[model samples]
Target: MPEASPWDGISVPAHTDYTVRQVPGPTAVPCFWGRDRSGACLFILDLDGDHTDQYRKNTTTINGIDVDLRGEAGRQRLVLTLEEQIDRDLFGGLCSTLIAALGNASDAPTSLAVALAHIRRWKTFLSGRAAHHLTPEQVRGLFAELVFLEEMLDRGGTAPAAVQAWLGPEMSHQDFIFGNTAVEIKSLSGTERSTVRISSEDQLESLNDNLFLRVYRLSDLPDAAGARSLNDQVVRIQARLAAPEQIESFDRKLVLHRYAPLPEYDAPLLVVSAVRTFRVAGDNFPRLARSGLPEGVARVAYDIRIEALAPFECDNDLVFGGGNG
Candidate 1:
């Protein structure tokens, strides 16, 4: 049987603006689940003056939900109200997920930060902008990014810093950005595939900054002893994070990327057959840049043959700096 939701058995008084039930758990901050006079659902976080401005600035319409900071001064509450169009079960899951994330925080400030970050992620999830289920290509793409992220983490840096550097899920032109250096990651299946797809003109364009392209050749090895599925890889990465906040941040990124630990993702285990790194610089590198395109030509996507990238090819050390690629 499914577990009972935090919103289970909660009711709202028809005469009042809201009827709330305090969340039952050892959370760093006070939280509540409620329903409004019209029977709409709500999740409220009672916050202090120190971070009220942060919450206020982030308040905005989240497609099927409304995010706002209510009350004044000492009684400020960051509220998330569910709209009629959203699925109640999904909202319940979201609320439950948020509560779990808040519970991991060490203090009210940390909780507030986590909540704000998560709300932004939920906005992306609810906007209908991301797919509910990751496609095969998406799975491979995300896997390659994770592989790069794992390599970064293995190189001995703060997990939070490394995870934060991953901006691909946020739709950044480059997958990973650190200062002026940017890396665009791609994955190809099987050895015979020779071309890599550049999704946008801005992806490889280097504007007074360093840019590199890293491609992973993946092979399906479902029966292989050490092969890993997408879900397995997620768990492995989570295990490497030392702090609760780091895990929370990474998990939030996964959510923003439209990943869920569904049973369907556990099949067709894969292994990285090979990795190729290339410097996306110099005049000879083949690419289509926005600056070079004709007027009004946008949303560009093109393919580059792998063999042609040889002149620009370089070691992974140039991109990640002394890391095991």
Candidate 2:
């Protein structure tokens, strides 16, 4: 940022919650944490070192942009850094998790860059830090999963599949036959706040009945092997519906049941968050720069959070929670 005018320094709010002093003057400054309900800093100007001017106290816009100094130049020029805007856009876990970790896209709140920086740290976050992480290829396999959901959501989000068992001795409802497989993925380097799931079983249940695909994403480890190691119960069930020669059919409409044990973790931070699921679709993980979320993964939608920790928790005493982050 350019140097501020003389009057600017006297009248502008640096926006920094904390400031570092240097030989010349103040050096670095902190940014907004987004959870300060007490409101932004208030300015009380003093004329001869006494009572002078005071501005109303309230939170101001946190763009990390220019200061709002009433156009004073020359000796009135000043320079200072205010706290940049924090990334508290994560919408999961009751707006509590988002209250922590204040900072800008450069750092804190676990930016995409930060998540990608440490394969190990990323894994830690995915494993115990956050929820599941969807790989690129697996997302493709779940196209039908998301597509079916989208169609359902478009059409009231739920409908009776009507594919019940044989009603009478020789009768049934709608004879629908489909295969379902449950898949689980694990990720160590997925974007921090980006929810990674092509289609979750809960959302699918909201769409239809007699079918379930439970996907559990594991994020305990940094590598794929680490994820697999967490829950190594590899139960691979393929589609088995092409049976011929008087095969015993199950339901009138096959209530296909599939599951994917995705990388397990603390929470399921989806790509889409509050108030804007349909607004953004098929974007990408917040941090990791994958070729794609598995081709044809067909992302129904996702919410991306710029911050890593929860909202307004950055400036808090426990930002790093006992230090050493």
Per-residue lDDT of 29-75 in model 1, one digit per residue for the tens?
89999888777889998876656665665444667778877887766
Q: Count the backbone clashes (under 3 Å) in each candidate.
A: 0, 67
Among these predictions, the greatest lDDT belongs to: 1
Query: Residue-wise lDDT of candidate 2 within 1-325, one digit each (tens)?
Result: 7443222223222564322221222112122212112332221110121111111121122233122322222211111122334222211111121111111122211221111111222223333432434444334223223323333334442223211221211221111212221112222123233444433212222112222222222233333332222112211001111121101122111112121223342222222112101201123313222233466544344332323212211221111122221
Alpha-carbon TM-score of each model against the true structure: 0.64, 0.17
Off by over 4 Å in 1: 1-6, 11-27, 30-40, 46-50, 63-77, 128-134, 146-173, 177-180, 189-194, 200-202, 205-210, 217-274, 280-301, 305-313, 323-325
**What is the C-alpha local distance difference test score of each model?**
0.78, 0.23
Best by TM-score, which number? 1
**CA displacement after TM-score superposition, residue 174 of candidate 1 (Å):** 3.8
- The local lDDT score (0 to 100) that residue 239 gets in candidate 2 is 13
| lDDT, candidate 2, at 18 | 25
lDDT score of residue 296 within candidate 2: 59
